[model samples]
Target: MVSCPFAVSCWNKSFPGSQSIHTQVLEVWLEKMFGKYSDNKYADIVTLCWALWRARNDVVWEKKYSRVNRVIASAKQYLLRWKCAPVTCSSVLFRFVVEEDGAITWVRPTRNSIKVTVDATLFAERREYGLGIVARDADGLLVEAKIKCYSGTVTVEYVEALGIKEALSWIKNKGWQEVKLESDCLAVVQAIRCTVEMQSSFGQVVADCRRELRDSNSISLLFIKRSANVVTHCFARASHRYPDRTFDWSDIPIEFQDCIQMESI
Candidate 1:
């Protein structure tokens, strides 16, 4: 499976080290890997394998080929359906709600809590990254926004971790007790929520975020689709127009007004 170009692409995107495993027996390798994976991770591995097999079958029997993105989406949709099935007990509950148009729209936080969306934009040529954060109240009105640029050529995952760390510090300074932090980076979110000790630099940032959250019981981190996080994305991209560090409490950037308005709808 790893030898196939399509399968390789999907594996690289979903599981980075999947191609590195060398074994003469596939079943033995899978059994060893399963012992190391969490329940959710195990589910993801099996579902993705199923997806790849189905895609291969379609091409062989029906003469129909599925794109890598389509196969990944099918796996995600199937996993989500399985998670959302009726169960008597489940430790984690997914909050993703798909719209009629197949888009995930931003939803307001409950009363007494605020929602903060964060995103990071990488300027690879400049060897720098921009972090943007926007906070909104229960009524969906903007409370504050910030855009900061940092000089570094870090991995996208690291940049995302930095954004969340910055957002948490900003929230702490504001003395906000109840806040929901959202980011478009799923890996970063999962790392922060995972109990496993992270040993890398990116893991250090995620550790800091977890420490910040531990100080406040009401604070939480969540993953959101890029469509639902458009406001923060625009803000991150707009950072190039401003100074290295900028914060806005009242005036919204003209370019970001449209995005904010769209989210408000």
Candidate 2:
């Protein structure tokens, strides 16, 4: 599965060293990946494996083919369903409580602290990427919002890393303290939180993020579900509208008003 051109593209988009992974046995490769990476990415890798296996079976038994995007989407849909499953056991400690609609809502930060959500979106047709950042106070009131666009043909992880780095730099410039930074990119979050050296293509960006975190004892980085990060996700999706690469939120855009209100609710 790793050697297949279609699977390779999906792996490379999510995992940086997937192209160089050389092993005759699939189990051996999985073992190596699990050992080399953080725990947060384990679910994603396993889900992708299942998706690829299902695709292969379809091709073999039903004479059907699945595109890379469909395979990736299938994996994500499965993962989301798994996450939305209700936890009946009272002893289990879960950070998020799945709602009736199975969507996790944005959480407010601790008193006197601010929460910053960041997300990145890729425009493949335009050969560019956009980043969105939104800051809200402990009461969930919007303090500021920003979006930036950069021209490049990079992997999803790379752009995600860039979004995080930009968020940290922006926070540092504002001299914000007691900040709770949130992102849906679990791999990037784990990479920054862990002390182990990152040797991937975005290692430098991760290093910069780590440096920023190390310098600020009051700031903490955590992972949240994409459902809870809808505001920033919307901003990232609408980033192409702002070619100047910066947004002035003195007057909030009409398109973003609903997203901002939803989070507040």
TM of each candidate vs. truth = 0.60, 0.62
Best by TM-score: 2
Where model 1 places Cα greater than 4 Å from the true spot, the runs are 1-103, 244-249
Best by lDDT: 2
Native-referenced Cα lDDT, model 1: 0.77
Per-residue C-alpha lDDT of model 2 across residues 1-265, encoded as one tens digit per residue: 7778888888887788776778868899999889878999899999999999999999999999866656775676567657755534343564333122123557788888899999999999999999999998887778888899889899999999889999999999988889988888877777777788768779989999999888889887877768678779878998888744544446777656655654666
lDDT of 1 by residue, 67-108 (tens): 776677567556655664553233256433222111245788
